[model samples]
Target: MVEPAEFRSYYGRPILKEPAWKQPDVPLYLFLGGAAGASASIAALADVTGRPELARAGRLVASGGSIASVAALIHDLGKPTRFLHMLRVLKPTSPLSVGSWILSPFSGLAAVAAASELSGILPGAGRLAGAAAGLLGPAMCTYTAVLLSDTATPSWHEAYGTLPILFAGSALTSGAGAALLLVPSVETGPVVRAGLIGAAAELAAARHAETGLGLASEPYRTGRAGKLLKAARALTAAGAGLSLVARRNRAAGAAAGVAYLAAGLCTRFGVYAAGVESARDPKYVVVPQRERLRR
Candidate 1:
C-alpha cells in the first residue's frame, strides 16, 4: 500500500541552473540561421539554373539573416565587443566558435553575392560566393542543434540524435518560404518540392523524438512549449498542403510562405523554452538519473 504524501520544509530554490542564453535573442538567432542557411542553398540552385531574380532574392535574404543572427548574439552577450572573444579559439567542443567561423564567411559571401546581383558586376565572383555559401549553409543550420544538445539540459541532450535532422528540415522550409515570398515568380516547382519534403521530414523527426524520448520529452508537450509546438505542427501541415498549389496561385504561395516562417520561429522558441524549463527544474534532472540507475 502507498503512504500519503506530506509537505516538507526546506529553503525553496532551483536545484539546477538555467543556461546563459537571453530571451528573444538566442531563439531569434536560431530561426534566422535556419532561414539564412536555406536561402544560401536556394541561391546556389538559382545561380545554376539561370534564374537571376530568384538568385538575387536568395542572396539578400541569406545575407540579411546571417547579419541579423550575429546582431542578436552580440546583444544577448550584453556587449558588442564580447563577440570577438568567440573568435579567439577554434575548439572542437565549442559550437559557438565553430558557428562563428561558419557565419563569418557565409555572411561575407552572401552579402557579396547579393551586392553583385544588384550591381551586375563581378559575375564570376558572385557565382563563387554563392557556391561557397551553399557549402556552408547546411552546416550553419545543423550546428545549432548540436550546440543545444551538448549541454546538461535533459530535453536537449536526449533528442540529440534527431535535432539536427529536424532542424535541417526546418531550414529548408524557411529557405523555400523566403523564395516563395520574395522571388517574384510563380514558377516555384523547386520551392514547393523543397518545402513539402522538409515539412514531412520535420514532422517525422519531431514526432519520433516526442514518442521515443520518454521523460525528457514532457516539456515539449506541456505548458508554453506545448502550445507553440502544437501551433507549429498545424502551420507546417497547412503550409505543406498549400505548397502543392503555390505555382498556380501566388496568393496561396505567399500564405504558405508566411506560415512556414512563423512555424520555424515557433519551433525554435518551443525547443529553447523546453530546455530552459528542464534546466530550472531539479526533478527533470534527478528523476531521470534515478530512473536510469533503476534500469
Candidate 2:
C-alpha cells in the first residue's frame, strides 16, 4: 500500500501571519450583517405585498441588526468613534472599504424604514428606503466573504467562490429566523419558503467548498472550527427539514427558526476560526502553492 506523502516546515512555524480580528466582535458583526441583510430583503417583500405587520417586524429586525453590527465594529476598533475614519473614501479594490459604504446606506435605510412605521412621517419614503435596502442588502451580506477571501489565508482564498453563496444563504436563513420569531405565525409563508431555500443553498455551498479544496481544506475538517461547522450543517439541515411542517405549526416554526439562527452564527464563527487556523499553519500555506507550482 502507498503511504500518503508527508510535508515539512521550518520549525513548524506559521508561514503567514494571523488575521488581526478578535472574537465576539468580528463574528457577531458577521451574524448581524447576515441578519440585517436578509431582514431588509424580507422587509421590502412585505412592504410590496401589503403585509404591514410583517414589514414592521422585518424593519425592526433589520434596524436592530444594524445597531448591533455597528456596536460590534466599534468594539473591534477599540473606540466607538474610530469607525468614522472608514467613511473617508470608497475604494473599489478593497472589500473592507466597499463593505463599509454598503453598510452605512443599508443601515440608514433600514432604520429609517423602522422608524417611519412609528413616526408616520413620509410613509411612502419608508417603502422607498426598504426598496433601496433590498437592493443593497445582498451585497452587505456577502462582502465579508470577499474581505476574507482577498486576504493571504489559504483556505478562505481557496473557497472564495463558495463563501459568498454560503454567506448569502446564511443571511436568508437568519432573516427567516427573525421573521418567524417576531412576525405572526399565521403570516410566515414567505419566511418559511426563504428558510428552505437558504438551508438548501448553504448545505450545498459548504459541501462544495470542502470537497473541492484539497489540502487547504484541512482547516475545515479539524479542530474547533471543524466541529462548529459540523454542528452548523446539522442544525441547518434539521431546521430546513422542519420548515414544511413549521408552516402549519407555530411551535415547530419557533424551533426551526431558532435552529437556523444558531446555525447562521455557528457558520460565521466557524469560518472565522478556520481562516485563523489556515493563516497560522505553515502546512496549509506552503503545500497548496507547492502543488500549484508543480503543475
Candidate 3:
C-alpha cells in the first residue's frame, strides 16, 4: 500500500507569510464595523416605520460603532495617513480601496444622522443622511469579508463562498442585539424578530463553512479557535432562544442582546485565529495544493 507523503517546511519555516493583522484590533474592527453597518440600516427602517426610540438607539449604536471601528482600523494601519492614502483614488478592483471609500462615507453619514437625532437639529438632513447611510450599510457590512477573502490566507480564501454570508448574518445579529439592549421592550418587535433571524442565519452559515472547508476547517475546530467558536455557538443558541421571550421581558431582551454581541465578537476573533493558523502551518498550504494538483 502506498503511504501519503508528509508535508514539511524547510527549517520549520512557514511556507506562507502569516497575516500581520493584530489581535483585538482587527477582530474588534470586524465586529464593530459589521454592527455599525447593520445598525444604520435598522435605524433607517425604524425611521420609516415610526419607531422613534428604536431608531434613536440604532443611530447611536451605528455612530459609536463606526467611530470605534475607524479608530481600530487606523491603529492597525499604524497611522491615520496610511488609511487616508487609500482614498486618493477609487479602485473597484481592490477590496481594500472600495472598503475604505464605503467606510469613510458611511461613518460620516452615520455620525451626522446620530447627531441630528440626538440634538434635534437638521431633522430633514438627518433623515437624508440616515437614508444614505442605510443604502451603504449592506456593502459596508460584507466588504470586510471580501477584503479578508481577497488575501492569500488559506482558510479565509477557501471559504470565500460562505464568508460573506457568515459576515452578513453576524452583522445583522450584532446590530439587532445592540438595538434590543438599548430600546424598550414595547418598541422591540422588529428588533426581536431580526435578532432571532440573524442568530439562526449566523449559526447555519458558520456550521456550513466548517463542514465545507475540509482540512482547511481544522483550525476552526481545534485549539484556541475551537474554543472561541464553541463559545460563539453556545451564545448564539442561547440568545436566539431567549429572544423568543424578549417581547414579554425587557431584561431577557437585554441579556439576549449581550449574548448575541459576544457571540459575534467571538466569531470574528475565531475566524482571524483560524486564518492565522492556516497560514502558519505548512501542512495547510501544501496539502491543499497537492490535492488540487492530483485532481
lDDT, candidates in the order shown: 0.86, 0.86, 0.91
Worst 10 residues of 3 by lDDT: 203-212
Candidate achieving the largest lDDT: 3
- Candidate 1 lDDT over residue span 179-279, tens digit each: 88886645578888989989999888878666779888888888898888888899899889888888888898899999899889988998898898887
**Which regions in candidate 1 have their CA more than 4 angstroms from the true location?**
1-10
> What ranges in model 3 sit over 4 Å off?
1-5
Ranking by lDDT: 3, 2, 1
Per residue, candidate 3 scores C-alpha lDDT tens digits across 68-156 of 99999999999999999989999999999999999999999999999999899999999999989999999978999999999988999
Candidate 2, 189-243: lDDT as tens digits? 8888999999889988888766778977778867988898899999998888777
State the number of backbone clashes in model 1.
0
Tell me model 3's lDDT, rounded to 2 decimals. 0.91
Provide the clashing-pair count of each candidate structure.
0, 0, 0
Q: What's model 1's lDDT at 91?
A: 82
Task: RMSD for all candidates, in order, please.
Answer: 1.9, 1.9, 1.2
lDDT, candidate 1, at 92: 76
Candidate 2 has its poorest 10 consecutive residues by lDDT at: 5-14
